[model samples]
Structures are given as structure tokens and as C-alpha cells.
Target: EEAGEHVLEVEVSLPELAELLGEELRLPAIRPRGREAVLSDVRRYRSIRRTGPESLRHFRRTFRTALRRQIAEGTYEPDRPVVVPRREDRRYRSWRIAEVPQSNAAVIYMMDVSGSMGTEQKEIVRIEAFWIDTWLRSQYRNIEVRYIVHDAAAREVDRHSFFHLRESGGTKISSAYELCSRIVEERYSPMEWNVYPFHFSDGDNWSGGDTRTCMELLREKLLPRVNVFCYGQVKSAYGSGQFKVDLDDELGDDGRVLTSEIPDREGILPSIRTFLGTGR
Candidate 1:
């Protein structure tokens, strides 16, 4: 019984768990034929399987032993059944410990949780952020993630509340930017940390003047101190969708400012790739 339990444990660790996920849902790096690609090729597909090829190597050896035993025992009648497995029949993949470059990255996630931003939008942000965290963690030895949820005012919150809190205050984009700048100044020094500020919103603002203040903060305070500032405008029936256009018109040529649109949950993956693909 003990030996049976050990075998069960070993089987549980196989890559078959990941393989069982449909091709579309599986992480890009572990997909069939994906092993040939370098980490740089799919940095945005951030899910990392904890069990590498080394884990599977043990199973391959065990399978070979089992096959040989079955053949010797005459459980496999080669002549009558026409069963054959040559020395070349055995295939075991080798895994090399990839030397992933160590870079410090700080991602500041700011979300608008005003009346216009609904639970569906928040869920989308939550899912995308999880994948982003996974990918960045794989690449960097040290990663710091800061969450700021904003309405007319903004405050730093823990990871749990960042994705779950529901509030109905008015929208003011600058408050979030200001809070994000303070977090950077206090915790993440730009000299040592590759800062990435990503803000998710429905493009609703309290006023045109507040939008101008947001631009000012990005240009004067945020952009200069970070590697990249990303803004994802989530589409909403109540939103005007003006903030993204404003930022694009103002900072279209600025490499530091990257922007994307998340129309729904389906767009989350591509948006994550767009934001992090630069390795900035």
C-alpha cells in the first residue's frame, strides 16, 4: 500500500496536469512545440509549471523498466502480437536550468472603482494582474507590486481589497496618480527598480481639468521616474472613453507611456503582452 501511495504521488507531479488543460488555455511556454522558444519570445504568457522536465525524466525511466519487465515475463508476445520496442523507442527529454536574467521590477496597479466601474471590470483586472505577476516573477529575482484603488480619492490597499473592494464615489484619475507617485517615492526608488505603473479605468473622469492634472502628473512626476506607464481603458456603457484618447494625443510618441484597451475579459491576455513585451 505504501509503495502504491508513492507511485500515486509521483503520477500527480507529472506534466500531464498541465497537458490536460486545453491547448488554448495552456500557458504558451509549456504548450506542445513551445519548448523550442526562448523566454524572451513569450514573456507575457506568465504561467510557470513548477514541475520541469526533470520531474518527467524519472517517469520515463520507470516506464522503460516496466516495459522491459513485461516483455521478459512473456506478458508481451512479440512474435504473435507483433509488439516491438527497440532501444530507440525510449525518449526522455532533458531540461537545462535556464539562467534567467535578474532584474528588479515594481508594478503599480491603479484601478478606478467609481460608480461607473462595475464588478465585471474589476474581475477582468484581477485575472489579468494575476498572469502579469506570474510572468514577471519568473523573470525577476525581486518583484514589488503596489495596488491603489481610486475614486475621487485614492489610497493604497492590500492585494485582496485591490481586486474586491466596491465603492460608488466619483471618478478623479489624478488622485490615483498622486498616490502612485508617493508610493514610488517612499518605497521604490527608480534608480534600483524598473517601475511599471498600470492604471485600469472606464475612461470616466470628474472633469476635464482633472484629466489635465493627470497628464501633468504623468509628464512631470510619474513618467520621468518609471520605466513605463501603462493605461488600460476598459470599455463601459457609462464611460465616455475620453481619457485614453487624451493620453494618446498628448503622449503618443513617448516611449515611456504605453496604452491599451480592454473591451472585455478576452482582451486581457493581449493587453498584458502589449504592456510587458518591451522588457521595460
Candidate 2:
């Protein structure tokens, strides 16, 4: 009798998930633009050489070399099926330094943490942000994410606090945009980095004046500097849902601006497609 072995395994890769999302949404590849810089050096083993370290030895090539020599020299037996490699029969991998370009990106996520945005809405934003991060990372070699949460005031926070923290106040969308603009001007240069700003809210602002200010910031400050400005409106019971309407009326014709309404969990996928489908 022969013994049998059975095993089960599960593995997860973020790049694989990103590919799945891309297939599901039929997302297009992003076209990166900028001067090429040698940000990092990559080792590519593209050729087999006669000599290299033991760790870099090429097993198949060495075997083939040994077998060919044995057959030509009449040392190989067909029935025995044995191959022994001599010192000169050894083969190894050779690598060359590949310069990777400096195509970096920054994703600034701003969310409304006002009293009206409930836990359920925040959960939706969290789910959406995960997908967004996965897709953007796949498109760029290096990506950095910044999080901001706001009510009447806006402040930057760490990843954990961004999703979990809650606040009670009026919604002033402009404050978040102003902070985002300042961050871009201070740290990320549009000339070198692809900037993406994603804002999630319940379509509630403190006043029409603040809404105007937000539009001004988008038009004068953010639109020209960013690849695209994405606005996601998550529905809430207390929210009036007027901000999206205003945005459509004001900036709907602009190619650099995108807006989507996330009514619930079901809307997450479509919203992601809407935001990233342009491949900007």
C-alpha cells in the first residue's frame, strides 16, 4: 500500500485583487507623464552566463550543457538516463541593473466626519477607499496616501483615526479642500507626482457661501494641479443631498472633475468605476 498526502492552502495578494477589480470594471491603464528619473535600481536576470555564484546558478541550462557534452563524447547511456556536469559544463544567471522611472503618486482622501455621517456611511467610505488604494497602487510603482476628516473644521489624521473618529458640527467642505491644496503645494509637486484627491461626503455644506468657496478652491487651486478630482456623495438620512446637484450644475462639463452618488453598499462598485474609469 502507498501512503497519500492531502493539503489545503489559501493565499491573498493585493495585486491580484487589483487585477480582479480592473477586469470587473473594464478599467483602462493609466498613462504616466513626467521626466524619467532613476528612483530605484532593479536587478533583472535576463541572460545565462558560464560563471556566477552558486546561488545564481541556472539548473536547466547547466543540465542541458552537461547532457549535450556527454552525448557528443559518447559518455551518456540512453538506458541509464544519467547526466553529470563537469566543471566547464556549469551555467549561471547574469543580471543587469534596470533603472526604474520615478512615476510616483499621492492619494489624498478627505471625508465628512460631521454628525450626519453615520457609522454605516463611514463603513461605505472605508470599503471604497480600500478598492481605490488597491487600484491606484497597481498603476504606480510608488504611492502615498494621506487622510483628512472634517466637520466645520478639517484636520489631517492617521489612517486609523481617519476612518474611526467621529465629530459633531456643521459641514464646511471648503476647509478640507483648502487643507488639501496646502498639502499639495507644500509637499507634492504636480510636476513630479501624480496627485489624486478623493472626497466623500453626504452632500451637506454649512452654507451656499461655503459651497462657493469650495467651488473656487476646486477651480483655481485643485483642478489644474491634480490628475482628477473625485467627489463621492454617500447618502444619509439626515443629509439633504444638495452638494452633488450643485457640483453637477457648476463643474459637470469639466473633464478633470468626477462625481458619483453612493446610495449604499451596492453603489460602491459603480462609484469606483466612475471615479477611476477615466484612467487619469
C-alpha TM-score for every candidate = 0.70, 0.75
lDDT digits (tens) for residues 124-228 of candidate 1: 898878767766565555678889999989999999999888788889999999999988888877666777788999999989999899999999999988878
Residues 202-245 of candidate 2 have per-residue lDDT tens digits of 99999999999999999999998899999999999999999999
Candidate 2 regions off by >4 Å? Answer: 1-9, 36-101
Best by TM-score: 2
- Show the lowest summed lDDT stretch of 10 residues, model 1: 30-39
Could you list the CA RMSD of all candidates, in the order they appear? 9.8, 9.6
Number of colliding residue pairs in each model: 0, 0
